[model samples]
Target chain A: MKEHLFEYLLRLGDDSLILGHRVSEWCGHGPILEEDIALTNISLDLIGQATSLLKYAGEVEGKGRDEDQLAFLRLEHDYKNCLLVEQLNGDFGMTIMRQFLFDAYRLPLFEALIHSSDSQLAAIAEKSLKETKYHYRHSAEWVIRLGDGTEESHERIQKAVNSLFKYHVDLFFTNHVDDALLKEGIVPEMKAIHNKWMESVKNVFSEATLEIPSNNWEQSGGRLGRHSEHLGLLLAEMQYMQRAYPNMEW
Target chain B: MSKNDWPLWEVFIRSKQGLNHKHVGSLRAADAEMAIENARDVYTRRSEGISIWVIESNNVYASDPSDMDSLFEPSQTKVYRHPTFYVVPDGISHM
Candidate 1:
């Protein structure tokens, strides 16, 4: 049970940590100043969430691994994030699309997790849900604006939507670890969360005039640590400082 | 490159429930919603406010600096309008 819980926590923690890292890459690169600050603020919130989750995971594992160690010392294959989060940020349209999809999934997941039998998970979810609500609003608004804006914006974001739709399925990926936790009432039912996610996606996409792809193919495996080529490059940069200067403290 | 220049807005924040919204700073945004959202990101990252209000910079009307005396010189001499003569009871606080 502890092992399964630890793995589940890693799945949650790694997703936030990696996506936070990805969003932080937009620190100085936002198309507008206000959006730059907004994206960076969201990145900070996600990293803050990652800190709490990874710290709790470390405690559950009973390994002296602190949040820093869990975050900085892990190899690419050890990460248990969804494949959607680890994908490269192609453009503003692509980035916003990625964020919108993830926020749709995460908001409901956190909302359901707030009722978990695990008190620690419930507490973290309660705190994270507030931030996720704001993130969802921001990303959803951007999606609607960009998707329905000028002809160029509409075209670019539509292309992004079609390209990124396949990764959405992996968010609800389940395995034996999840099954055990689900039976124990430690995690929410993925099917219910998926339904809520679909409703939200449909509502927002309808507003944005963006079409969901008819194809249902899904590219997954990040949760099982089978990541794409991108994760290696992301980890190389993320782990560079820690790898080069072992035990160095700021 | 300069095609996307959004309108400027002034941000006002009320730090607590009873406090009045005070102007904090200005930022550029495409609309009122974006202005408020930008204000939230730019001004309230430190948890500095409980509420935010944003107004377009162009919508605000300010008195002319050149007409300072014409607009305000008469008020300086109005000692009767001052509240210094009123004495508060001991129990009354924050008046």
Candidate 2:
């Protein structure tokens, strides 16, 4: 039970940690000053949630490792975020598309997690839900504007959707960890959440006048820790200060 | 990043329920919705406001700076228009 719970917490925490770092990369590089601040603010909210989650995971693991060690010390295979998050933010359109996909999933996931039997997890989900809702709004609005805007924006955003759409399915990757949490009443059913995510995404895409890819190609393995090459590069950049000078603080 | 022609918007924020929406600043956005969202991100990130209002900068008509004397100089000497002559009763503090 402890092992399953610990693994579950790590999956949750790693998702936020990796995605938070990815989003923070947009801090200084958004398309406009307002967008720059908006992206960084979203990144800060995700990182703040990651801090709470990873800290709790460390406690649950009963290991000496704290949130910092868990976040920065984990190898690429040991990290459990979906490939969708680790994917490069190709352009403003691509970043908006990627974030829209993730936010759609996370909003429902957090909403359902609010009813978890585990009080700690439920509390975290409740707090993170507000931030996730705002993130969903931001990304969803941008996705629509980009998809339905001018000719160039429509073309660019369509290309982004085509490229990023493959990763959306893997976000619902479920196996023993989900089964264990499901049996323990610690998580909502993955299928239900997946359906909710699909409905929401479809509604938004239809409104945005974006087409869904007909091919149902599925990509998985991020949950099991197998990841694309991007995660390694991201980790190298993120962990440099920690690895170069172990235990250093400012 | 290259689209510099996005229209400019003026942002107004109501810090609390009872207050009027005061002009905070300006930002550029593609539309009114985006303007409000951008204003929320830029101005209200630190718990600064409970409501927001945004309008395109072009919609606002302002008095010319050259008209300052004609528009305001006559009112400056009209000190009797001030309502400060009467002291409120002790309990009437908000007046």
Candidate 3:
């Protein structure tokens, strides 16, 4: 049970770590300067969440491995981040779509996990829930504006939506870690989580004048340490400093 | 420039809804919707505003720098326009 809990926390931590890094790439390259700052703010929030989750995972593992160690030292096969997060930032529309989909899943997941039997997990979830609520709102608003805006924007954003929809299904899929956490009351009901996620996504999509894809096939493997092509390159950049200068710290 | 490169917008933020909007910064966006998004991103990241307004920088009218003296110097001598001319009643506690 302890091992499973640790794995669950690591999955959460890795997802945040990967997505944070991906979004941080847009810090200075946003379409507008204000959006640059906003994306960076969201990235910082995700990184903060990763720190908390990884720190808790370390405590559970009792191996003295800190968040930095977990984040920088992990191999490609060892990472448990969802494939959705490691995806390339093709364009502004793609970025917004990526964020909206993940935020949709995370906001409700955090809301439910706040009541976990594990107080550390609950505390982390409680704090992240506030940030995720804002993240979700921000992304949802952008999705609507882009989808319903000018012809060029509508077409581009809709294309981004269609391409990214395939990855959204992996967010709610329960695995062995989930099974163990459920048994211990360390996590909430997955079916209920899925339902809430669907409702939220549907509400946003409807308002955005976007269509929800009918395809049921979803990509996976992040839970089992598999990832899309993008993860390795992102990890190379993120882990470079720590990997090159082992034991160096300020 | 392509339509994607919208005009520059000046962002004004009110710390609270009832407060006056103050010029905070500028951002380039393709439209009013994007301008508002950019303004929210740039100026309000630190919870600095309760509301935001974005107007195209080109659309705003500004007083010419050469007109500064003529536009303002005469007002200083208009003491009758000042509220200080009114004597407050001694019993007006709140005032």
What are the Cα lDDT values of the candidates? 0.93, 0.90, 0.87
Task: Please provide, for model 2 over B22-58, each residue's C-alpha lDDT reduced to its tens digit, 9 standing for 90 to 100.
Answer: 9999999999998989999999999999999998889
Looking at candidate 2, what is the lDDT of residue A233?
99
lDDT of 3 at A184: 86
DockQ, prediction 3 = 0.41
Query: Which 10-residue span in candidate 2 chain B carries the lowest summed lDDT?
Result: B1-10
Backbone clash count, each prediction separately:
0, 0, 0
Query: Which is better, 1 or 3, measured by TM-score?
Result: 1
As a whole number from 0 to 100, the lDDT of residue B90 in candidate 3 is 89
Clashing residue pairs in candidate 1 are none
By TM-score rank, best first, the candidates go 2, 1, 3
Q: How should the candidates be ordered by lDDT, best one leading? A: 1, 2, 3
State which candidate, 2 or 3, has the greater lDDT. Answer: 2
Per-candidate TM-scores read 0.94, 0.96, 0.85
Chain B structural similarity as TM-score, candidate 1:
0.83
DockQ of each: 0.66, 0.83, 0.41
